[model samples]
Target: MIKITFIEHNGTQHEVEAQEGSTVMEAAVMNGVPGIEASCGGACACATCHVYVDPAWKETTGSPEVMEEDMLDLAYEIRDESRLSCQLRVTPAFNGLVVRVPEFQA
Candidate 1:
C-alpha cells in the first residue's frame, strides 16, 4: 500500500493507504477523507476533488492531463499546484505523497 497524506484547508491531516493502481480520489473517498466530494467519480468530468499537490512531491505527482486541466478551471482558488485528485494515480514513489484540500469545491 502507498501512503498519502491529505491536509485540509483548516490544517486537519488525513493519512490514507492506497493501492498502487488507484487514483488519489479513490483513496480519499474509500478512506472517508473529509473535503473530497469526488462528484464525477474519477471520471475527470468535475473538479470537486480539487487539491494542491505538496511542493515537495510535485515531481512524483506530476501535472494534470489536458482534460483534467479543463475541469480544474472550474475549481476554486486555482494555484500552480492545483490538481484534480481523480487524475493522480498512486505509485510506489507516492508512498509519502502529500496534497492539500481546499476549503471549497467547484
Candidate 2:
C-alpha cells in the first residue's frame, strides 16, 4: 500500500492507504477527502480532480501528459506543481506523497 496525504484549503488533512495501480483520484474520492470532486470519474476529461503536489514530491510524480496538461489549463488556480489526480497512479515509490487541494475544488 502507498500512503497519500491530502491537505485541504482550510488546512484539514487526510491520509489514506492506496493500492498500487489505482489512481490518486480514486483513492481520494473513495476515502471522502473533501476537495476532490472527480467530476469526470478518472477519465481525465474534467479538471475538478486537480491538486497541487508538494514540491518535494514533484520529482517523483513527474510531469503530466499533453492531454492532461491541456485539461489542467481549465482548472482554477493552476500552478507549476498542479496535476490532475486522475492521471496520477499510485506506486510503492510514491508511498508518502503529499498533495494540497485548492480552495475552489472543495
Alpha carbon lDDT of residue 70, candidate 1?
96
Error of 2 at 15 (Å): 0.7
Model 2 agreement with the true structure over 5-91: per-residue lDDT tens digits: 999999999999899999999999989999799998999898999999999999999999999999998999899999999999998
Question: Which stretch of 10 consecutive residues in model 2 shows the poorest summed lDDT?
Answer: 97-106
> Using TM-score as the measure, which candidate wins?
1
Alpha-carbon shift of residue 23 in model 2 (angstroms): 0.5
TM-score per candidate, in order? 0.98, 0.97
Tell me the spans in candidate 1 whose CA falls farther than 4 Å from its real position: none
lDDT tens string, model 1, 1-106?
9999999999999999999999999999999999999998999998999999999988888877889889989999999999999999888989999999999998
